[model samples]
Target chain A: MNFIAEIDVMPLKELLDPQGKAVAAGLKNLKLDAITDVRVGKHITLKLEAADKATATAQAELACQKLLTNRVIEYFTFEVKEA
Target chain B: MNFIAEIDVMPLKELLDPQGKAVAAGLKNLKLDAITDVRVGKHITLKLEAADKATATAQAELACQKLLTNRVIEYFTFEVKEA
Candidate 1:
């Protein structure tokens, strides 16, 4: 079986986001007054082949830990689709 | 005009991702031995009403800073579409 997954990582609200801040400033330069804040992150979409949905999901999670995200600051989730 | 945006944030590789690691372990429990890595983050989709694509993009970026994500660790981007 194969599955598709969408994953993401972000800074916790209590944390500071310099990248976001820089983006915010950049947005301001674009003259968007209604915009006040900016945060940044990554979104990954991929398909996995495995024996079952459960197995595929497990593999996807493992992939997230080792290759998709760093272990110190990121948190992630996904809805897996079997094909 | 209106636009839809997808946004994400993640830990840099230099940073540690306890969240991704935890997810990886959880996946191991699910019996997905083939999986090798995991990373975690947030994804948001929203529609913005504005005067132009450029203006809408600016507003979308602002929304990301103030509402969509936290600014400490997150950096984000989007592809805006007029609706």
Candidate 2:
């Protein structure tokens, strides 16, 4: 079966996100005062061939752990669905 | 009310995502041959003050249009929920 994995890799909440802070500051300059905070991360869409959902999920998990994220600073979550 | 908007900014399907292609190559080198394709994008989380969902959604949309995306090559989608 073919599957699609939507993966989100985010900075650990305990850590400061400079990019987010910068975006918030830019928003304030734009007079978007209502926007109080911003956090930016990576969203990845993967299309792959797998025998089943479980296999696809496992493959995605491995990809996240091995290449998609920096474990010291970021964590990842993913959902696998039929393509 | 305080609201959170989860926004995804993606490269247009017609555009070539060099970053995505690079990741796919890295995955292939890692021997994850089951994965056939990858697309990388930005995921943004926004915290804001708004009177209601509609207001929050509108704020997010405005942010996307004004500062978060390059409309010529990318598009965005968002979901707003109570924070």
lDDT of 2 by residue, B1-83 (tens): 99999999999999999999999999999999989999999999999999888988988999999999999999998899998
Best by TM-score: 2
Q: TM-score of predicted model 1?
A: 0.53
Residues B1-83, candidate 1: write the lDDT tens digits.
55666665555546667786776676567666554455565565444556778877776767666655566665665677754
Residue A28 CA displacement from its true place in model 1, Å: 1.2
DockQ each candidate and list the results: 0.17, 0.89
True contacts kept of each: 0.23, 0.87
lDDT of 2 by residue, A8-68 (tens): 8999999999999999999999988889999999999999999989989999999999999
Give me the candidate number with maximum DockQ: 2
lDDT at A45 for candidate 2? 96
List runs of model 2 lying over 4 Å from the truth: none
- Candidate 2 share of real interface contacts: 0.87
| Residue B64, candidate 1: alpha-carbon lDDT | 64
* Alpha-carbon deviation at A14 in model 2, angstroms: 0.7
Candidate 1 residue-wise lDDT, A1-83, digit = tens: 66767676556657777777876676567565544555566666555667888877766677667666675776666668865
